[model samples]
Target: MAQRILVIGRSPGVILDAAERLRGKGFRADATNQFDDVLTDYDTATVDVVVFGGMVPPDSKRQLRDEISKVNGHVTFVQGLAGIAGLIVAQVESVTSAAGDDTGVEYDAAERTVRLTLRQPAQVVVEAWWATSFTPPEPASTSTRVVDSRFDPGEHVVPLPAEVPAVASFVTVSVGPAVHTFTVGAMPDAVRRMASTSALPPVRAVATHTYG
Candidate 1:
C-alpha cells in the first residue's frame, strides 16, 4: 500500500508544489500551509508520513511534532531541508525503506553516470528531459529520451545515455518504486561528455517507446 503523507509548512507555494510532485510519484498526499489546521487534519486523516517544509516555524514545528507523536508513536516525521520536489521525495523514500526495498541508486551528473545497488531483480528506466522554456517551477515545454532494461540483483554502473538534447534540464532514473533525479547543468557540452562513454544501450530521442 502507498504511504499517505501530510505536507504542512509556512510556505504555501512550497508545500503545495511538494504535494503535487508527491502525487505524481504515486504517493497519497495532502498539504496545508496553516499551522493551526495541521493537528485537526492529522488527527482526522490517515497519515503515515508528516513532512514539515523548510520554512516552518520552530515553535509550531516542535509543538506539532509533540502532539502528533502522542497520537501515533510509530508515524514517521521528515524535516524538509529544501523546497525541491525531488529532494522531498527522496527524504520520504529514505524513511520508508524499513524492509530494504530501496534501489540504492546514485546519479553523478558531472560524469553523467548512474550507479545502482539493486537488492533484487527489477526493471530499470532512465530518462532525460530537455527544457524548451526557461520557466520556473514547471517547464513550459519539454522533450524526453529514454533507455530501459531488466537488471539483475547486485551492483551496476551505467553511463548516462548520450544525446540528451541540447537543452536538457535533468535526468530521471527509475527502478521499481524508486526515482532518482539529477540536474545536469548546461547542454550540448554536457551531452557530448556523457556520450563519450562506450556503453551499449542507445537512448530513444522521443517518448514513443523505450530502448532495450
Candidate 2:
C-alpha cells in the first residue's frame, strides 16, 4: 500500500492540485488550506508525510510540527518548497525518501549532458524519447533508447543526442521507477543562440606585391 501524505498550503486549489499529482505518483494524498484541518479527520498515524507549501506560515509550521510530533513520532514533515508542478513532485519524492526509502534518484543537466544521482548503488535504467510536444506518440511510432547499467552511489553523466531539433521541448528521461520529462535543448537559450550565429572570416588581399 502507498503511504498517505497530507498537503498544507495557503491556497486550497494549489494544495488539491499537488495532492492529485502526488496521488498519481503512487501516494494517497489529501489537501487542506487550513493548518488545523490536516489533523481533523486523519490522525498523525494515518498521514505518513506532511508537506507544507511555499506560502505556508513559518511560525504556524514550527508550532504544528511540535504539535504533530506529540501524536505520531514517525510522521515526516517537509516545508519551503517551490510551487511549480514539476518541482513539487521532485521535492515530495525527496522528502518521502528521507523519511524511509533510500532508493531515491535525481538528475541534473549541463548542456546536452545529464547527470543522474542515486542515494545508493542500485540498478538504474534510463530511456529517452525526444519530441516537440509532451504528448507521446503510439508505441509503434515512438523510438526509445534504453541504457541498462549499474552505477555506484554517486553521480553519472549521460550524454544526449546532438541532433535534437530546436523545436523539441524536452526528452522523456526515465530513471529507475520514476520518470522526469523536460526539455534538454542542446544548451541554454543565450548560449545556444550565441553558438548559432555565424561570423564571416576576415578576407586577405594580395595587393602587397603591386606596391613593391
Candidate 3:
C-alpha cells in the first residue's frame, strides 16, 4: 500500500501541486486548507504524514498537532519552511526513512572535511554555513560551502565546497532525507575542498519542525 500523505496549507495551488507531485512519486496524496476538515479527515482515515505550509498560523498548527496526537501517536507532522515544493517533499521522504539509527558523521574545521557513514547507497548533501543570530540563514545567504550527490554506503571523505569566514559556524550532511548538523569554530582561512575533479548539482535540506 502507498503511504498516505495529507498536505495542509492556506494556498490551494501550492497544496495541490505538492500533493500531485507526491502522488507521482507513488504515494497516496491529498490536499486541503480547512482546519476543521483536517480533524474530520484524520478521524475518518489513517494519514501517515501531515505537511503544514507557511500560511498556516502557529496556533492552528499546535491545535491540529495536539488533536492528532491524542488519537494516533504514529502520524508524522512536518512544517513547510518555505513555499518550495521539493523541500516539503524531502521532509516526508526523510521522516519516513528515519527508522534505523545506523549513521555517523564527522566534521573537521582545520581539514575542511565532512566524513559521513551510511548504511546504504544514497545521494548525499554536505553543507556548511555561518549561522548567526544577526544574520539568519533563511533570509540571508551566509553559507560557506555546499556539495551534493557524492557518496556510497561505506565511510567517505568530502570537502566543504566553500570557504568559511573567521567565525564559528555549522556543518551538515544529508543522506536521503536524514540530515546531521555539526558545530565548528571560526576558521577565516578555510578554503573550498572538492571530493572530485568533476562537478555535480547540489541537494540541500534544512531544519524542519516535526511533531508526533
Candidate 4:
C-alpha cells in the first residue's frame, strides 16, 4: 500500500502543488484547504503524513498537530514554509544518502537555508519510547477567556478553560537532532474552538486511523 499524506492550509494551490510533488515521488497525497473538511476526511482515510500550509491559524495548527499525533503515532507533520523547506531536504538526504553536498541549500530567510541530512532509524525508536513516557495535562472543559483575540502571525496559543480537566494526551517525535511535541484534549469541542479562532491558520482539520 502507498503511504498516505494529508496537506492542509488556506492556499489550495500551494497545498495541491505540494501534494502533486509528493505523489510524483511515490507517496499518496491528499490536499485540502479547510480544517473541518480535513478532519472529517481523516476519519475515513489512512494518513501517514500531514503537510500544513504556512497560513494555518495558530490555534488551529496546535489542534491539528495534536489530532495528527493522537491518530497516527508515526505520522510526520511538516510545516508549509519553514518546515517544508527543512523536510524536503531531509527526505532527499534520506533517500539519496548523499553526504557533504552543500549544493542543495536554498535560502529562505537571510540566516536559513534548506539543510538536508540523513536520519537514523534508531531515532524513531527513541522517539517512540519518549512519547510513551511523557504525559500532558488535561484540557479544560470550560472555555478559557483570552485577553486579546488579535495575535501576530505564526504564534501558538493554548486556550484552555480556567479549570483544566485531568485527562490529556501528548505525543513526542524526534526529527534529526530535535524533538517535537504535540498535545490534545479529550474533548473535541475544546480543540475545535481553538482551531476556529484566529489563533490557528484557516485550514480543514482531519484525523486518520491506522490499520496494522
TM-score for each model: 0.55, 0.51, 0.56, 0.42
How do the residues 1-212 of candidate 3 rate in per-residue lDDT, one tens digit apiece?
Answer: 77888887655545666777888888777776676566754441377888887556567778888888788777888876444354456567666664565677778667878877777788778666652332111222245446778567898888765465445455666776676655555323321122121342332322211211
At residue 149, what lDDT does model 1 achieve? 87
Provide the RMSD of all predictions against the true structure, rounded to 1 decimal.
Answer: 13.1, 20.3, 11.9, 16.8
- lDDT at 139, model 4: 15
Q: Which candidate is the best by TM-score?
A: 3
Candidate 1 colliding pairs: none
Q: What would the per-residue lDDT of candidate 4 be over residues 1-212, giving only the tens digit for each residue?
A: 77776766554444555566766766666666666556655642356666665456676778888876776677667653212222332332243232332222121222211122322222221111101111111111122222222223331323323243323322222333333333332323443344345554333333322222
| lDDT leader | 1
> Global lDDT of each model?
0.62, 0.53, 0.61, 0.41
Q: List candidate 2 segments past 4 Å from native.
A: 97-114, 117-174, 178-212
Ranking by TM-score: 3, 1, 2, 4
Which portions of model 1 miss their true places by more than 4 Å?
Answer: 24-26, 97-114, 125-149, 152-154, 158-174, 179-212
Residue range 1-212, candidate 2, lDDT tens digits? 78777777654445656777887888877766555544554566657788776445556677778878888878888762333343455556755643343444343445555567667765555544433222111101122454577777877777655554444224444444455545443323432232123442222211111101
Candidate 2, RMSD to the unseen true structure? 20.3
Poorest 10 consecutive residues by lDDT, candidate 2: 203-212
- Candidate closer to the true structure by TM-score (higher is better), 2 or 4: 2
- Model 2, residue 204: distance off in Å is 71
Ranking by lDDT: 1, 3, 2, 4
The predicted structure with the larger TM-score, 2 or 3, is 3
